[model samples]
Target chain A: MISPSQVEVDRDKGNFHYDTDYSFDAGIGLSEDVIRYISEVKEEDPWVLDFRLKALKTFEKKPMPTHWATEDLKNINFDVIRYYLAKGQKPSRTWDEVPDDVKNTFERLGIPEQERKFLAGVEAQFDSEAAYSRMNEELEKEGVIFVGSTEGLKEHPEIFRKWFGKVIPTSDNKFSALNSAVFSGGSFIYIPPGVKLAQPLQAYFRINAENFGQFERTLIIADEGSEVMYMEGCTAPKFETSTLHSAVVELVALKGAKIQYVTVQNWSNNVFNLVTKRALAEEEAEVRWIDCNIGSRLTMKYPGVILRGRKARGEVVSIALANDGQHQDTGAKMVHAADETSSNVVSKSISIGEGRSSYRGLVQMPGHLKGCKNNTECDALLINNNSQTDTYPAITVQGDANSVQHEASVSKVSAEQIFYMQQRGLGEAEAMSLCVNGFVNDLIREFPMEYSVELKRLIDLEMEGSVG
Target chain B: MNSLKIENLQASIEDKAILHGLSLEIPKGEVHAIMGPNGSGKSTLAKVLSGHPSYKVDGGSATLDEENILGLEPDEISRLGLFLAFQYPMEVPGVTIANFIRAARNARLPEGEKVKAVDFYKELYEHMDDLGMDRKFTARSLNDGFSGGEKKRCEILQMSMLSPKYCILDETDSGLDIDALRVVSEGVNRMRNPDRGILVITHYQRLLEYIVPDYVHVMSEGKIVRTGGKELALELEERGYDWIKQEAVA
Candidate 1:
């Protein structure tokens, strides 16, 4: 467990790193040999190794989606990026047993303190593997299984093999294929039926190696009548050359079950964060995604939900902030396949300096589905003249009984408003921050208390030097 | 020495001169009123003193208690104990009045020392009641979609809460009915103490009846052309501004 005084955790202060001396390092570039090396090192089952080999072929066959994505995607040279780097294969069950360097990094991130305060379980992943993973004794007694992906695959093959690639397959997209080929260190959680955890399970992903690509695969399953919440945070030190982070997260909610997934990623401007997250909800089940993206050079993520059973509900609440030299392309997607299914999406974005932000949403209700309802609202705030924002919503509703509503708006922080607040004793930056917070006030209230406070502080730090 | 003294204040906006070498003084323990016609630069004076970015001060020396405030930022001037109640308060959507005022108050406190929440709310409610405002207004957005009279009362609410050394009310009486005028005037009158100075800028003499001024100055074109006592307001209301314009030309 780490103390509060040992950490100076400012995600924007990107100068922190620990010396790396990994015993296993699969040099640079992507090849069958590299994938084989990773599978061989993990001692994975033959089927899992076969899956990786096939996914590597899929990754090689697909091209970068530069037609819709930013041209910056072309700048990434896959041949030079280190595919895998890890200290060891297995994660320690206790913090004291972890290596000193890895433990120090997580300590500086305040993960142990957070675990002690509110988290029921914690997994701190340093690079390609988790350094420490633990859950509460009471939760373990309740048959809740929480561990890193490596352990989950080897130890709980019966459950893991059932829903491993059922929700989001490797063929879902190019990034998903890439992730499936060389993925490591993410959480695999299973909440037993009728067991409702009071505290959330947390995972912290830290990218410590330079010129490295971190691909973490996460899967969460909530059984019938169970409820669970999972949160993940990602950060990396600034590197001279750009780094890559492509992760795949899939969720499953059984009948009468509820699952909430929250993510707050504040990567350095030198990292490209592209992730795929989706959830499948059965009869009377609910799934909610709360996402906040603060820092990244280019981030393209659209968390989605597939409503598969009657009376299933889905929701997505997202807030993205793009500062100078950053592009945050994010939104939500909902696919209704059952009668009486419903979904809602609310997204807010702030663009400062020369940053650009866009919202691309997709909502579909086929002709067979009846009594389906979908509502989406996206609002954008531009802080400077050079800031840019865009929205592209694709909605297809066929059945007359199905309905969809969408609203979007773009607003700027006016000079007069800033002056008026300044006359009331607020500094220029403070005034801007207040207006921005107010713009996203209604949506921010939905965030938890701890996250809302941290979000406000992060916005204040980004608002500095925003005004002349 | 303890006054808001302006000497040869020259100002303009967008290359168009609005105030041509205007000057006035409002010392402590006094309230002054400036009556002017349309485009007479009365509003410009309020903006110039508060460091509005649109208005440029070509040449002037405005001081508060011997500290020059011409080149200071708007927030700096505000922290120096000067408050401006805008005629049209900009609407800050989603920012509740309570939080907005609390931020202003927090800015005045020393570092790391915060206002007690209970005591602050108590004082705020009392002030809101004095202005005849509903207690629920504290939770509403700041001046967003508020009625004309409600906006005026909110301005007065902020003035009383800030309790600055000098207060400038720009057209505070405009767009208000008689009943609202009285409630707003009472809110201002409560802030009238020996340690503060108030400057009221209005186009008509209607507001002067409720909040009587110690001195009255008539502004024509860009500068003050007549100075008198409170009786001058009655005279102007009877004769209108035509006579004052004629007198200033002569």
Candidate 2:
């Protein structure tokens, strides 16, 4: 088995190959012609083509965000972005069948090894398409439908048509509309009723093509009495010019079912990672979102949950690390729409150097709901004097019997704490890292074993040279 | 050479004076105990000697074997061979005890040198065993979720690993029961050596019974009011602080 520490070292080195051979025309922006061209290139069905066209119209009608915390959206220059770039490769079923360059990329990222050791299945996506996808025989025999979204649309139209865009409609936001219009190369998982997958299904997304936007649409449906854990890992080669990764993910947990989704997003510093992910929990169903955001130039993601059935539960455990020139504006949103529902949201962020990390969350208990409860706690640690952090949590409790609580705190690595560690012989930087690691250790423990180790190493790497 | 000395120490918190004109010296190969009542500035003296930022030394000085330590940072003071086992050890959430001590040991090494993982773990396990700490505690966060006794043992475990020339255990026996106090004292006793000096701070004489000190000093209102042999602790425990207060007033 590959040690998680080694993965951490490799992630810090970030020596992934940037495939310069692939190039696409960037002047082509979002348009009906572009949508039709994408459909033609994918050989998509006529109905899928019509859906893309309708989404393109919605994308055009929606206005840019006027109430976001930052103003970088005004400079997006959508016309300069290449909405879809296939990189001239079709999805392969076997690792050996994949091109050497693409396979080597996944190998360096430790995806193939992870698949063999612990993952029940694996899907590796490069740029705009899944270059390789596979499932273990045991899972395949059990009738689990795990494939790339595009393939799912083609093979299982019945399941695809019924739930696609239902959780997050095209008009949800400007970025969601854009993703719906040009989405490609994400996972589609359907766990059969009453069947629990023993191991997590994993996917790795990489952006090796420059000036390209990766809009992968992922949808997971856990049927009644079923349980499954899905993990998504993403990275991109460092590019001088900014790349955009705007994807939308939707999850549905049927009555008495449970779904746990884990995401470890470590993009290069030159990418803007703006994603919208949400889930719908039915009667007595449970949904959990465990997200770790470690790297990006600017990231704004809030994984949300809507409790639609009585006695359903929703939870979100998130950790964000923002270092030099990065802004991680992330949190979770929970809406209690049914009676006797409960939700918990715990968010921890660490800001180093001049980085800024903010938590913006919402919890609403409508008047129709009775005996609902929601609790949110957002804590931030600033490593240095120049770093900054903020928390903005909004909780609206309308029902008389509902309860809501919100707590937030921001603290710096105390000089005395560093001195205490240093007196034991640690240098200033090592002491600061230890204190910061201890500050977020509780949240890190919530992650899978491998991810928790990798997250610590990532923090250590970002902490190097952080103190004078 | 392994001795700690404080000369006419004057310190304050937030510019308000606390420890004023206090002088004490502890020599190597001996254990000294400081007994005091509430608000006697016992904790502040420990913090100032370790260079806690909350306290500013407006005047006076302290030294660990000829090295002026008042100007150095708390960590620097520790690295210079003094260790303050905090009365209330901060609960460091994500850092395991092994890693925390390892970082401390690594800091002591010259730049570019690294500690071998195998040797580090071996040493940690041995010290943990000596302190009667479970091997699993090495993997747990430092002092996080630890009982009062377990926290004190953790401090002793750290003191053992660092092997400081002068160890100042601030209120080491606070909140400990009879069994826990004995276990913690045994851990400290195991580390007793001719090359080390220990200063144990406590309110009750029960701790001194197990980790008996060579000398005992009664501190009242930031100054050492009286100094005597080990029997001083026994006398105070029997008669209480009123006798010490009467002596100080006289």
DockQ of each: 0.61, 0.37
lDDT of 2: 0.85
Which candidate has the highest TM-score of all? Answer: 1
After superposing candidate 2, which stretches have Cα over 4 Å from the reference? Answer: A1-11, A23-28, B1-27, B31-80, B87-91, B94-157, B169-191, B199-250
Off by over 4 Å in 1: A1-14
Name the candidate that leads on lDDT: 1
lDDT of 1 by residue, A1-468 (tens): 001111222355434898889988999999989999989888899999898888988888898999887899898888999988998647888888999888888888788888888889999998899889999999999999999888899999898789997888998888999999999879899999999988889999999999999999999999998999998889999879999999999999999899999888889888989899999999999999999999889999999999999989999999999988889999999999899999999999999888899999999999988999999999999888888999999999996999999999999888889999999998887888899999888877777666788778877777776777
- How badly does each model clash, as a count of residue pairs? 0, 2
- Local accuracy by lDDT, each model: 0.90, 0.85
List of clashing residue pairs for candidate 2: A423-B75, A438-B94
lDDT string for model 2 (A237-356, tens) is: 787878899999999999989999999888888788989999999999999999999888889999999999999999999999888788999999998989999999999998877789
Alpha-carbon RMSD, each predicted model: 3.9, 6.0
